[model samples]
Target: MIRLAVVGVGKMGLSHLSILGAHPQVRIEAVCDTSGYLLDVLGKYTGVTGYSDYEKMLERADLDAVVIATPTRAHATMVRAALERGLHVFCEKPLTLRSEDSEALARLAEERGLHCQVGYHNRFVAAFSEVKRLLELGAIGEVTHALAEAYGPVVLRPKGGTWRSRSAEGGGCLYDYAAHPLDLLAWYLGEPRAVGGTVMGRIFSADTEDEVYSTLFYPGGASAQLSVNWSDESFRKMTTRITLTGTAGRIVVDRQECQVYLRDTAVPPEGYHHGWNVRYTTELTPPVWFYLRGEEYSAEWAYFVDAVAGEPADGAAAGVNSFASAAVTDRVIEMLVADAAVPCGVAAASGTGASGAGVSGAAGAGPGSRGARKRAFWSLGKLRGE
Candidate 1:
């Protein structure tokens, strides 16, 4: 069995512990948190050592790996410390709020040959996995264009108040929630070639944007439009959908049921397109829940366990949630910030027509501290060029 230590006893961290408990091959060795009350409460059921200091837990526990679920700003330092000590890491999303730090951690993990998994869990949802397969089988002949949107409450608190509201803490909905759609799109299509968007801080008092709608043009003339909002209600009201248009047929996966549809035709085709036609032709069916639901967390954990054990078998293919992908998301967030000030495709005063500013900083450093602050350093030449 692989021994594990969970850092941070928040809801997410607790969820990880509970999910892993069901896996027979895993054992929870320790639970660490700064809250003494929380640590004591969780320690009772976990039956593991508890520590308010993560460093103390790491030094004392002879464990196989650690789950870093702390605040976004602390990801880089904590993840690096674990990998340097030869422990595999499973961290939550945005990997790091900044690109540079994420790059550094990726390099460090590669150098040490450690397994690092980020939190973009939607990749594991069976609905998406099936969508990827159907696309591979040419069910949706070459995807012409796609659009993804995730609108809900702003998960971040204000910098002075909570973690979700501050740009410095990576609190915006773009990084926290929309990350699923971004990663999903990138997975279905290829890497995004160009990304530009507009962010509006409409309702929220926090510094970062509460709503963002973006357009990403992919290679091969394919493009994707993304709309994400914290102010709207989407979870229970409208399910997430991915519409893929192709020459042969079009596939739609309503977070409810993964379904397929073809332009109405009298003659039926053969081979792979068999069972799915009747419903699309007849009437709308109930949404399909593709994943095992319970397996969402276990699948990821199992992959991490097997990968760390070195008995590898398509483990990486299961969806790594690497730092690089998080960097891409970071770039999109930066583009939104830059685009907010200046319209996309418009040439600035510098005579050169650069679209937006490239906010560079250490990965996982958070937005306000890096991207927001970096924009302040650029002069007219730099700004116009940016």
Candidate 2:
């Protein structure tokens, strides 16, 4: 059995603990968090050791892997400590608030041959997974344009916001909410060449943007638009969707289903037809050992467990949801951040009557300058590797 520990028994952490606790190949080694009461309660009832101090737990616990569900600010240090201890790590999403930190951790994990998985659970969603498959099968050949969106009722009438609303702590619609679709965009299309028309607006939260909108320019004439709003009460919960239009066909997908349309010239995949095909997520998803918030949640953990057990990944088409991929998503966020810093383009702002022209002189990152930044980002060695 693989010895495992869980840090930060928060909502997501507890869910992971519950799911992994039922895994036949995993042994609960220790649990750590700042709450002594929670630790005592767990230790007393669960027959598992608990510690209030993370460092102390790291020093005392014997483990093969760790699932870190700590706050965003604490992730870099905690993950570094775990990696230094020669333990594989499973970290919650947006691997780090900074791209450089994520790149560093990914490099360290690569050098050590340790599996470091990020918790981008949507990748495990069957409909989303099918998008990856269909794309690989050339169902939608040579995508020309795409739309990625995520909406939620998160910050409708924000009171004192939690760590999620603070930009410094990796909160905000851009990082906390938009990261979901942004990561999906990165997975579907490669890293964007540049970003423009970015609007990081705050609806209720004072510290961070409650909504995000941006345009991502990709290579080979393909482009994408990102639209996200966490303050949208129209959606009861967070909803993510992607729409792709290609030379051969089009695809639109959400958690529930994947809709595809193929041109007559396009050759359909095995189960798909030339006109239109719809595949529900329920039919695409396989059963998981433990069900939590969704099968995607447990499915992600199962992927991590299999990685720790040295099993081959689901397939190269599914891709490895590692720190490397998260870093790419971070870089895309960084691009959007830089783009939003430049003043919005208004026709009245310039005599040329061009809306694309911004007010900033040399201080702003425009399309040309941002593409150079993307080149530097892509220059990083094997940022897409295992």
Best by TM-score: 2
List model 1 lDDT by residue over 1-386, tens digit each: 88899998687787788777776778888988888988777767556789888888889998989998887888988988898899989998878876668878888888988878887766655666667767766665678888787765444343347576676876766666677787788678866655554556556444666676777777789888887776674454423567677766776664444666654441233433433542231122222222234445666666677777887635325545766666666555555455566423322356344764443334435343444434433421242234
Per-prediction TM-score: 0.78, 0.90
Among the numbered candidates, top lDDT falls to 2
- What is residue 70's positional error in candidate 1, in angstroms? 1.4
Writing each residue's lDDT as its tens digit, candidate 2 over 1-386 gives: 89999998989899998988898989999999988998898989899999888898888898999999987888999999999999999999889988889999999999999999998888999999899888878877899999999998888785654788688988888888899999998888988877777889988998999889988889888999999998998999999999999999999999999999999989898888898899999999998888888999878877888888988867732446889999999888877886676544333344645455544323225433545444434433223331
Off by over 4 Å in 1: 153-160, 237-239, 263-294, 314-319, 343-386
Collision pairs in model 2: none
After superposition, the stretches of candidate 2 with alpha carbons farther than 4 Å from their true spots are 316-318, 347-386
Shift of residue 371 alpha carbon in model 2, Å: 15
Score residue 335 of candidate 1 by CA lDDT.
53
lDDT of the candidates, in the order given: 0.67, 0.85
